[model samples]
Target: MSLAVNPRFIPPAASTFVFDPDLVAEGRRESVPRYGDPIWSVLALTQNPSAPDDCIRWHWFSGTFRETFRFAAWTLVNHPLADQELARHGIAMRAKLSAGRIMRTVHQWSIFAAWLDERGITRLADLDTEGLADFAFYLAKTRGLSRNTASGHLTGLSRLHYYGRSFLPPSDRLVEPPWVAEGMDDYLPAASPLGGENSTEPITPATMGPLLVWALRFVEDYAEDILAAHDERRRLLNAADAADGPLLPDSGDALEAFLEGLEAEGLPVPVAARRGNPLAGAGIYLAAVTGTPRSKVRQVMRKPHWRTYTAQNHGPCHLGTPVNATLDAEPWHEPFTFDGIDKMVRHLATACFIVLSYLTGMRSGEILGLASGCCPDPEGPPAEAGRHLIYGRVFKIATDEYGNHDSAGVVREAPWVAVPQVVTSVRVLERLGGDGLLFAAEVHDKRQPERRSGRSLQLSTLNERIERFIEWVNTHAENRERESEMIPQDTHGRIGAGRFRRTLAWHIARRPGGLVALAVQYGHMRTLVSEGYGSRSRGGIHDLLDFETARSVAEHLSEVHEAIQDGEGISGPAARRLIHSAAQEHHRFGGIITSVRQARSLLADPNLNVFENKDTFLFCNYDRAKALCHPGRSGKYEAPSLDRCKLNCANIARTDTHARQLREAADSLVRQASSGLAPEPLADRMQERAQGLSELADQHDRKRVLAGMEGHL
Candidate 1:
């Protein structure tokens, strides 16, 4: 026998539920949500302070499901008993969950509720093992979601059960677990062995080179003219807005005076291109030249002489804002045409985005969240001569002032180190007005004043803008007959903001002393420290570096194997060891790395120290005891200093390619010595150096072994 409680005496869960103490203390009362509110505002709980209000709000349910599960959803997130039960099941309680995680939970629960409603089962107690199995099958088969995604939905349902059983009335409680006999794994698809590779593809060299070159050109060269035109257009628009009522009585006389001045100077009215033909708009051109309101210019254009002047002087006009940028000694762009200033400004902003994203390697959200003056010029510049830093918030691993998961992110202690190009890009963006954010949503569409929203630009919108930039680049290249300079389509389909960081990692890892590597090495030492600290974990850029390094190692080994097969001999002290190790690795790993762990493990092999030194025209088959690059250094060296490679180092290895490059260098030196331009002493030194290089090449040719002829060497 059970005691019956009166329904009238029971209090609503919303009235009794308590908010987190920290949140209540920190947040404004009006911003904080009551448990019973239809939309729970979690803006104060977000890690990104720049995140829009809509992004943090949790709208429980929409459409028909709202009426069916409104009370149930409220209880699941608010009731203390439900929260305690969820904590027991190893799920985070409402107060601990981040805004993003709570939103995902709500979305998943809504899907399940809608599915249950379709089957005419409304209450949690009505759900059973058979219905759960059918739902799993529907997620896996009908919906066709990936195994990981479907598993997430199932996990959400399991949490729902833990909370549902703690309901006030026993009739609404679920007595048994949702997955009675089987778990979520049993319903998921089989996992793949090679599944840990990052999905974001690196931008190929073909695309990245031209893309960056053009972006820099826009930022450094075309920026001045574009800004000038933008200002001129804005001034005209302001004048138009401020002029009240009708045209002034002197407006027609002013317009006629401007036309007379142009005629006297033998200058045609300013014409813009329209459908391959030059056409002049009297009102707009007169307004621009005479500094009058365009609204008044329209009234002046209605006069008879205005039509006669435009018809007689209708021709292409060369007048515009003067620009200093040039290509191949010719002006890169025609003088800025004020009529097309808006398009130019949009393209300028896109160019800045490309430069900042690719060069700095900041995550898209962090880059988009940048405010004005984030990277200010130094005041006196005495502390560090060349250190340029960008100060901004990092949301990925941020915490609040009280050491909790903060929705509003904290300022990063170590600012991002920027290159000169990145600094220039930021300065250019500053000139383009946004409320505070560098990439505000309304920055690109300033012509539409009514649409100003002061929100950070969305990633999806940036993706579209990137596509337009590419199209404009291709068209410009085609017009100039420089087809090779056009940015080609990447194999990874459309390039998005997320791929830049991975691409930067790939370039830095594979090309040790190339341009990108040098920039990263000097500008971002903090990244190196983070990489070292997180090397053991699957975080930071180190994992990407490992993957790319492993790939480079595998390709080198495969090339060595093929050279041995082709009867090409390797010459060095470690040649025999290199041959043996290369053959073993080729057979064992099959020239493929499946995951980051596998790449790290493969790179840990000490016997496989084949370092490609393209700058020195040889491979360093490095043995620390035998290396001469680190002169007078202590016990053991981790890697050969290829930049300081000695010509006579025992660790050096020479192949046919190395031999060819050596011969070419020797011949070039000989030519320089015989040219008679050098001093006598310098000429003698050049000849001696040439002789030594020729001997090394000859020695390699004589000592190289064929396949199965190691005994002779």
Candidate 2:
């Protein structure tokens, strides 16, 4: 029971006393860790018996350590003392530290060991406060690590001193914790001013808009053709598998008849895209068409009649079922041939990923973690008409009922609210035919069955796939001469999985039309939409929303300040107050808000009542007493209901830009009235509306005040 026994007493290969003996007793004997084991598979020691082996396994430092550094450093990490200390630390704080955290600790220990070996300090007892200080300096100055990252390295070393007392002998244990006197902060570089800013850039609207449009085209329009080709390929493979015996007596005749049928219908013989030799292409395609094995088809192709037929039709053929989806009133793509079916299916899956990730605002991992039935069709009438939900496990910040870090992750109690598009994407993924994860690694390739670990597609691989999807879409658009519809290259670089949720939050927070689109198109209530996204503790979509909202407000204020400086005029009850406050804040902040806190403080100023209402033709310089948008609502903070703006509201503000937009609206109404398609009464109403909008614009031009006239106003 005592783990404090001298290390010299036990052989190197002996089992370590790190695991809970009671749990080890119940587990298979082979799963136990030995001191000399090069890689320790330790999931058996944890309560999560079903966790993946890679998640729990600890590989002792070997390959790169041995190749790059001295053998002594490699031995230092592989040493029995190092093993005991880390094992003790892992077991003692298993509740707080996850399997991934334990792995990170081991990595930090290896780095520390390498630093010790370089300095020829063979034993921990030889290390003192001065040596620890040198190591801290090495990490910051030599390694060029950021303050936070250096602190992480120092934290691991400090834990060694804390945990080593119980596991290491007195001579091997450190005399004191690392940075005990001055704290780790003193030894590290000063934190950067932009250190805590969220570095993940949201995808710009130009890029995301076209990307989602094409993804919808794939999911809603072209899915049937891709999936049909997928089904046909699967059926052919199944038939080939079942026909293991020798070829049928009439197999050659059947293939001949099929070729004749193709000729009679004036359809070209189906051939693989890149296959050069006619006989080879014929063998492959005829086998698929005739439900015969490729080997059997090759044998039959040796006949003189078939050789003549293939010679006449040597080029690649597009002879599959044509899909009904169209682009610009024409077919979007050619018929789905067998040669490119696999590629189309992979693209279809990627399209589903894009739709699901962009629309639902689910993290990449959560989307990939989805199973076949995660978003099944609702059963009851009430549920059928209700919101669709996707049920999946969340790994980040996931915990078991006992409040322990669960490496296996926990099923999310509140599922992600899915729009109709997301629901369709899930259904398409289900039809693609993968078990367990919807985006399983083996879904695209089944040749390497040995490598099938039932894990979801990796983030790096998915990123590459996204790039390919973009290239394919651009190519397709170019071929159709629709250059205007191509997805623009994002200035932020490649569109990775992490960008989707951030971009969704940015759109929801900054774009009022975006909110209405989500409500009308996606059937989402604003409250439930935010709640669904913010339910995951680690998602931070709500924080992103807050930051984006604040940033938008700051930008709005900056624009107003610039407009006023340019001698623009404004008219409204609150216009004079708005101009004065904007001028004051601009002077106070130098018109540059650098941080979220500064932005939030700017938004809190009651005198700066400039609220953006871009969808409408005016800004709301809101005063609750004169507000007509929300009459009876009272709270610590309130927002103007821009959707219900009244024409005569006192809070309405109009600058030159708003007046121009009003004139444009009037022109549009006049054009609609003269279109000749409307009834006489409706046309008259439209003309009246146009006249009213024109009068409003004329009134704004008459009463608008120039800058520096606030005192007279």
Candidate 3:
């Protein structure tokens, strides 16, 4: 007997019961939903969408998935699963898979559907355990699929059959899979794990260090030109008479006319790339400046308007309130100008994307998803060290109680501890626009300005913008050194969204922990413990990078340990302790560490592995509530003052690579002191720091140090 439910028992379309109380009536949306509740209705929820080809082209689904695959006479029309993908049928499933994954399942289901129809298998009774086994064998042997792939296809077909059984006519009801593949892994072996580096490898120091220096220095270096030019353009616009000619922002069409005028006068104007928006290249400037994403840049520049901060003495100030022409006193309608002034706004947003993504080990999506006023208590100082935070949205898969991606994905309200640069970027964004999206999309339908909705820069658009932004940087650099160092280009275009988090993690992992600034020691173990106590959410690239950073540290330690075993010498006051640590805890069973447990135990000794003091360049192996460099030596295994590292600490160990750096430092300091450019006191301090490093290097045998240093770093 067929074991399928009756078609009449199935529930009707979910849209009939969807209750969205917050949806606004057309044309009069003066206000939108709050951050966490941003659900507007879509036409597809009510009716069948356009052809798969056309549907995938829309901004929402424009990923790499090719939906229009040809399979003879059949069309792969797999309907959307309600509680998955979107806030779809409201049945949010727990395991939120990737788009590529979802597409693969649907494709497999469609292929199975085609096979069944071709074989004239019209009813559930037509298929049995024997036929299912035959198909599985056919998939494995005839089609040359691995056994695991064949098993997965069988599982997918079973799921499709179960879902369709209730909806199909009684004659077509498909029973559950007759055979189960679970626990048969020994018979049908799983795919082997990948060896070597993952394809999306972390950015190396040689590739990323120069870019970091450029991004950190560029915006401020060009600040005078960027802002002065912005002010001049604003003045020109504000001074123009309405009756005499067109003004900026009043008509979207006026932008073209203004640029044409510049060109006619033999002046420079923003140039567009071939088949690309010339105006979008400026986003790179903003990405570098703020390290946010293209979306944020677009929102702020769409309409550059903002409230002004006035002098305290200027009675009854309303800095952030919307402009009330008569009551807004003056400077109220000032162009949040730099945005269009030589494409400054977009540049600033791009700068924000680049810096935050690179420095904080954050995903580009998380940084770009940030909204206005995302920073917490900016006017007030942080209550404790490492408490400064930035509020932003995370774009990874998240679940509601039902396990589906929540409507807002994840509204990251708890402040992500931020550095000062991020804080500054937040403040800059706040001043760019009023209470709408901070980084608004470029003016899309210039004729219908009033009807346009505020939008973020789409992923496809952002990728293009990133490329253009890189080109823009190359064009503006003073020389080839600066230009080539920006984002080494190729046919694949500029560095991508994935590089930032991994690169940051790689650099942080490589920090020489023992001692650069000798006075400070950090409670790095405490920090690691604290991180462990917090959420171990690895959905975002940023979260994954955190684990990757820890892994990198462990890997680096193993490399050093192996080198020492091969007859490398250690240096400094702690050399004996370091060698002893390396000698005793040799890792058990090597050759591509398949077990994580073994890897952890391999680097567990405090004497062998060092923790980094993020605040200062100190790696303390201090323990016993007695940090040698921490004042009074009074912190436990997890509580050292990273800011108090002193080069004289007994707990510190020096590597050969670090000795070379010390030599360079000592020579540089001597040269500076000899020259008239360095003052006496500053020169003395530099000499003292350099001398400390020299003493540590001098302790180790020069021949041994020189031989092993290359391997240490």
Compose the digit string of candidate 2's lDDT tens values, residues 47-90.
33223343222333344332222222122233333445445444
Mind giving the per-residue lDDT tens digits that candidate 3 earns over 1-713?
11222236432232321222234335423322211221322221111111011111112211221111111101112233333322422221333333333445555655555566667765444677667666666676567776657666765655445444434444444455555333334324345342212334565555455545445443334333444555454444343322233223433333334434544665543322324443444433333233334444444445423101111111211112232222124321333333344455456556656666664555565665566777666445456435456666555554567554443456653446555565655555555544544444432112323323444444444455555666666664534344545555443335676666655544444442432112111134224323532354444333333344345445545555686766655665555555554444335332233333444444454554454443332245555344555455443333344456766676665556555666777788778877878889988888887787576556554534322353452
Candidate 1 CA-lDDT value: 0.67
Cα TM-score per model: 0.76, 0.78, 0.59
Error of 1 at 113 (Å): 5.4
Cα misplacement distance, residue 162 of candidate 3 (Å) = 2.8
lDDT of 1 by residue, 1-713 (tens): 11222243232455422244354434233455555566665544454534545322234444545533444444444443344554455543333445666567667877787787788876666777777878888888898877767877876666556555544344455544445334557777555444433556788978887887888889988888888877877776565455434566775566678777877887676666666645435355556567667777766655677557666775553335677778778777776665677778888988898888777667777888788899977666668665567888777666555344565566766666677788988888888864478877666655422213454666776788888888999998899888988999988889887777778766765666445522334214334424332334422455776777677777787787778888777776556666766787688676777678778777788666677777666777777878898786567456566667887787777777678888999999999999999999999999998998888889888877655765655
Q: In model 1, which residue pairs have backbone atoms overlapping below 3 Å?
A: 45-407, 46-407, 46-408, 47-407, 47-408, 47-409
> What is the full ranking by lDDT, best candidate first?
2, 1, 3
Best by TM-score: 2
lDDT of 1 at 549: 69
